[model samples]
Target: MSNPGSYPLPDRFDAVLAEQDAEGYRCRFAPVALSDLPDRDVLVEVRYSSLNYKDALAVTGRGKIIRQSPMVLGIDLAGRVVSSGSSRFRPGDAVVVTGQGLSETEWGGYSPWQRVRAESLIPLPPAFSLAQAMGIGTAGVTAMLSVMALERYGLAPTPRPMVVTGAGGGVGSMAVALLARLGYPVAAVTGRAALHDYLTQLGARQVLDRSALAQASPALGNERWAGGIDSVGGKTLAYLLAHTAAHGAVAACGLAGGADLPVTVFPFILRSVGLLGISSSSTPAAAQTQVWRRLARDLPASVVDSISRVEPLSRIFELAEEILAGGVRGRIILDVRA
Candidate 1:
């Protein structure tokens, strides 16, 4: 491996920065000085970052994902450590950072180089290359965490299918692929009918129309899924809960569809359904490591490639708009060096 000192570092690097303006928020590709980065334990030469729903929100100003202004707008990044103040990491060490207040309270991975808290870094597993790690990124981590949560709640592979809502999106795509790889049948739900083949190619046994589950469901409906991973909240989540089998669990992660859950406690009280809320942003580093390991072991590289595509960091604004409009099919890996 090449030492960090072997490569000449740039004084200024390109970054997608979001700044608060009178109109609200505006994102642009700006040159940021290396000295401007936060004083953290590690300085990473970020090679790749991945766009998630949260990133789209931050970049497009569609949601309040950034707690501070003039923030870098990427939630997931993978790269090599250029310098480290902590003993846990060394120069040239591969690392990945997802969440940990990134693009929120802290400067994030949209930059070609970023200073990150050492505790926020997970040594990249041997099973994945840096690009592949970002391909999985935050979306894959959330999916693995959701699967782990479901198992911890007593769910397992069974004849009954596990439904994944918003299946064309990053989190939902990862969830479907992970669940299917682990031997669970998956019913992939999406509003885009064109993604049927795409979802099936990712190992979904069934492709469900999102409209079927987007309606306000009864308090308790006929049990259908053994469980589910719902990235779309609101009516979609309500439907998933109402139809979940007894003692089954549904992991709720995102609110792309809406925020409110318009359903009674009948599903919980009557059928003992489990509602597991998955928040990857605040997950402990140790837990994040475990989730990444699980992803490396279970999620196929081909699936990752199929579900994600590489794009230059320069096009982030247009890409962010596309993602917010639900035009993006899956994960968008940003090549910071490009």
Candidate 2:
């Protein structure tokens, strides 16, 4: 492993840069001068970056994920700080960066080197390697946040299963694994039958077909799940809300399926069900620290390793397309070292 500030520093490095114009948008792997990075308080030598759904949208120009162009396209990264003007961090400190509008309004983690705001960086947990940290990425952070909501809201692990929608994807897989590892019975829902064994390996107690939960549920259906972590919004959220046990909470994260909630307020009013919205991006540093601590303690290393795979930076373009089309499974980490 390369120690912080030990590797010969490169004044320029390869990065996936996205640019947009009236004609359209284009993204390519190219060398970027270190001096050109957005001015910030800390400079990190990013070792690993991860491909998330947001990254896919930003890289493919399929969605408005990037607020500015000619920016890097990775939402999460783990590395060693090489230099810092901020007193909060120092050279050789292992760090992880996610959210904080990264790859959106700011340069992000798709490169071997990046300048990041000091406030957005967290000390990587001692238990995790840089690869493991990037494996967790923003998706895993979001999952941990969702589980934190459920636990903090007084929904403890019980015999009654918790439903995790979009179980084949990054966030969903992480959620299922984290929940199950914490003694919660997890019912993972996925559209791809091919990933049944994969989800099972991640600790899902049971796997449900996506269609089983996509149909509109009655205003107040039979309470099936004790709690729910929903990544696929729209109908799946509606179903989870309708079938959630009384007083149970549902943490809604992503809007992969659709955004509109085509359901009435019956679930809330009748069942006293609570819906908590999760935003991994823009999370306060204090909260992010708490979540990362919980993740370090609760998420087993085997589970994290089982749910992610590595891909070199060169394969990112095709990986982005697969992720956008819902064809990819698990997390994809990009090895940025060249």
Candidate 2 deviation (Cα RMSD): 1.8
The Cα local distance difference test for each model comes to: 0.91, 0.89
**What is the C-alpha local distance difference test score of candidate 1?**
0.91
The total number of steric clashes, by the backbone 3 Å criterion, in model 2 comes to 0
Candidate 2 ranges with C-alpha deviation above 4 Å: 1-6
Cα RMSD for candidates in order? 1.6, 1.8
Please, what are the lDDT tens digits per residue for candidate 2 over residues 106-129?
A: 898988889999998999999899
What is candidate 1's TM-score against the reference? 0.97
Query: Residue-wise lDDT of candidate 1 within 240-335, one digit each (tens)?
Result: 999999999999998999999898899999999999999999998888999988888998788889888999988888888898888998888999
Q: How far is candidate 1 from the true structure (C-alpha RMSD, Å)?
A: 1.6
